[model samples]
Target: MTTVQATFDSVDPATGEVVGTHPIAGPEEVQAAVDRARPAADWWASLGFAGRAERLGRWKAALTRRAHELADVVHAETGKPHADAMLEIILAIDHTAWAAKHARKVLGPHRRSPGLLMANHAATVEYQPLGVVGVIGPWNYPVFTPMGSIAYALAAGNAVVFKPSEYTPAVGRWLADSFAEVVPEQPVFQVVTGLGATGAALCASGVAKIAFTGSPGTGKKIMAACAETLTPVLIEAGGKDALLVDADADIDAAADAAVWGGFSNAGQTCVGVERVYVHERVYDEFVAKVVEKAREVKPGTQIGPITMPAQLDIIRRHIDDAVARGGKALTGGTVGARFVEPTVLVDVPEDAAAVREETFGPTLTVAKVRDMDEAIAKANDTTYGLGGTVFSKSRGMELARRLRSGMVAVNSVISFAGVPSLPFGGSGDSGFGRIHGPEGLREFGRPKAIARQRFRAPLVLTTFARTAKVDERVEKLIKLLHGR
Candidate 1:
C-alpha cells in the first residue's frame, strides 16, 4: 500500500479561482521541521551577531530586490490590492534591516554595576538564543505581521519554523524561499503549510518558543497547548481598535484617516479602526467629510474583497443588527457576493455587536460624544486593547496616554506600526508579549547574568567564617546606605 498526501487549494476570494495547492503538514512533519531547526539554530548562534548580521543583510537584499514578485503572491492569495501588498512587503523589509543591524547592540553582552553590597564583583548581562522558535502567522498582513517575530528571532541567533495562515500559505512559502536563497547551508527559516492542526502540532513540538498572531480564542488554545510543556508563547490577537476625533481636530484630515484606516485591506487589519468616537461639537462636520471621502472609495480598486469567506456573513449580520436597533447607514449597508462596500453606521447602541465585537470587514461605527472625556471612556470600554488613534492637535498625547491599548498614534492613523523601533502587542483580550524593536529582539532570547569576583572583601557574607563583629558592621553599613 502507498500513502497518499492530503493537500488543499488556496482560492482567490474575489473570483473563486484556484491560486495554488499545498500539502497539509501533519504532526509528524511538523515535528520533523522542528527537529531540523534545532541543529540549525546551534550553528546559526555559533556564527555570532556579526556573522548572522552579514547573512541577514543578504536575505534582506533578496526581499528588497524581488519585492514585486512576492507582492504578486500576496495579492493573489489575500485579494488585497497589489499596492497594499507591496506596502506590507516594504515595511517587512525595513524591519528585517533594522533587526539585522541592531541585533549586536541590542543582544550582545554588556557590563552592569555591581552595587555596594557586591562591590568587589564584576557583573555582566547578555541575551542568548533559545534554539528554535515557531511562528504562526495570520492571513491579514501576513508578511509584515509575522516578520515582527521571524526577523527578530533570526537576528537574535535562533532558527525559525513558520506556519503561515492556510488562506495565505503561498505568501509564507514565498518568504521562506527567498530566505533560503541567501542561507541554503541550514534551515534557518522554514515554512510548514497547513491549517489549525498544523499550528497545534507546532505548539506541542517542544520548540523553545512560539509566536502567534490570530484571534484571542485561537491564541488561548495556543497558549494552553504550549503550557503542557512549559514552553513560552507570544500572541498578537485581533482588536476592536478605535479612532478618536477631538473638538479641535482637523476635520478633513481626521475624516481621511478614518476612512483609510477603516476600509483598508477590506477592513481585515488587526489594528484597523473599527469604531470612531467624535466630539459632539464637530461630529456633524466630520461625518459629512467622512461620507464624502468614503463614497469616493471604489471596491476592487481601492478596497479589496474580504479574504475570508466566513467574514462576509459576520459583516452582514452586524449591519443588519445595527440597522434593526435604529442605527442609520450614511454610506453603505449591504454585503455583496464577494465584497462589502464601505458601511458607515451611526446611532448604534454601545452594546450592539457591531460596536462591541471585532467585525473584521469594511465597516465603521461612528458615535458622538460630548467631550474628550466621554470619547476616552467609550473607546476604552472594549474588551480588546490593541491599537488606537487620536486626532487632537493639542491633546493628542494626553488622550493617547489614557487609551488602554498597547500602541497609539497621535494626529495620525496606525503610524506606530510602520516605525521599526516601536514595540507592538496588546493587553487584556488582545493578548500579551511584544514583537518589534529592542523588546522584540529580547522576546526571542533568554537573559543570562554573570558575576565574577575580582577581589575579596574584608566583610565577607557568603561563607560560614563570618563573625558577630562582621554581622554588626554589615548592619551598620545597610543602615547608613538606606536609612534615609
Candidate 2:
C-alpha cells in the first residue's frame, strides 16, 4: 500500500466559505522544493545587482498591475475589507520597489578605509546573498509582512521558499503565481503549502536562513528545529504593544489611533495596541474618547472578523480574566462565533492577563499613570516589544525614545511599516533581526570583506623572513612614534 498525503482547506473565517484546497507538503516534498531552489539560488545570485534589479522591477510592475486582483484574494482568505487588503498590497509593492531601486547602494561593494598600519592595503566589503531563504509567514497581514522579507531577499539576490500559514495559503499562492508571470525561468520564488510540519521541514532542509513571523512559542520551536543544522533564523513573534496618551496629548487623535491600531483587522495585528497607558490627568478623558470611537467601529464593517478562530478563545479568556479581576468593560465584554466586538476595559490592574498577555483581539485595557514616566514604565513592562505609539503634543519624541521597542510611531500607529526606508523588527520575545530598509538588505546577505595589498611595505611586518635587526628597528620606531 502507498501512503497518501493529507490536504487542508482555506476557509473564510467570517462565513466558513471554502476558498481553496492546499496539499500538506511532507518532509520529502519540502526537501524537494529546497533542492530545486539550490541551483536557482545560484542562478539568481549570478544576476548581479543591475540584472537582479531589472528582474525585480518587472516583478514589481506585475504586482502593481494586479494589486487589486491580489487584494481580492487577500480579502477572501483573511476576511479583511477589500480596501484594507489593498492597503497591505500597496505597502508590499512600495517595499518591493524600494528594494529594487536601492539594492545596489545598500548591498553593492564599497570601499573601506584601512587603518594607519594597513594604509598600504586596500579594503572593500560587499554583502553577498545567502543562497536560499525560507520564509514562514503569518496569517495576519499575510502579504505585507512576508513580502518585507521576501522582497528584500530577492532584491539581495537569493531564492526564496515560502511557507505561508495554513489559514491563508491561497494568498501565498497568488503572490508566487503573480511573480512567476514576470520571471518564469526558475523557481526563484516558490510557495510550499502545509501546516507546522512543512514549516519545520523548511527549517531543516538546509536553507540558508529562516524568517518566521508568528507566536513566540512557535518561534521557539522553529529555532529548536533549525538548531540541528545551525541554520540561521529571524523570528518576528508576538507583541503586546502599548499606546501612551500623555496629559498634553490630543485626546481625539490618541483615541483614533488606539481604535484603529487595536480594532483593525479584528485586532489580529502583532503591533496592535493591546494596552493604553494614560497620564492620570487625561486618563478619564482618554477612556471616554476611546469608548466613543470603539462604539463607532462595528465588526464586519470598520473592522473584520477574527481570521484565526483559535484566537477568539484567547480573547475570551483574557476578557474573562480581566473582568473577574476587578476590571470593568466600558463597551464590549462578550465574544461571538467569528467577530469580536471592539472591547475596552478600565480599572484593569497591570498584572491582569488582559494587560500582560498578547490578546490578539480587538480589546484594550486603559490604565492611569501619574506621569509620562509611569506611562513609559508600564508600557515597557512586557515580554514582547515589537511596536509602540506615543500621542503627545510636546513629549512625543522624548517618550518614544525611552520605550523598549524596535519601532515606534509618534502621534501615529503602525506608520513605520509604510516607510520603505525604515527597518522593522523588535527586541526580546517580539523577536530579533530586522526586515526592510538597508538593514533588511543586509539581513539576507553576508558581508564579504576583501583586503589586498596596494604595494609592498618597507617594513614588511607580515613577511616570515624578518631579521632581528628589522624587529628591533620596528620596535624602536613604534615606541618612538607612539609611546606615551
Instruction: Please give each candidate's TM-score.
Output: 0.99, 0.98
Instruction: Using lDDT, give the best candidate's number.
Output: 1
Instruction: Write the residue-wise lDDT of candidate 1 on 1-484 in tens digits.
Output: 9999899999898899999999999999999999999999999999999999999999999999999999999999998999999999999999999999999899988999999999999999999999999999999998999999999999999999999999999999999998998999999899999999999999999999999999999999999999999999999888999999999999999999999999999899999999999999999999999999989998899988999998899999999999999999999887999989999999999999999999999899999999999999999998999999999989999999999999999988999999999999999889999999999999998999999999998889998988999999999999999999
* TM-score of model 2 vs. true structure: 0.98
Q: Say which candidate scores most in TM-score.
A: 1
Q: Report lDDT per candidate.
A: 0.95, 0.92
Superposed Cα deviation of residue 110, candidate 2 (Å)? 1.4
- lDDT, residue 468, candidate 2: 86
Off by over 4 Å in 2: 1-4, 476-484
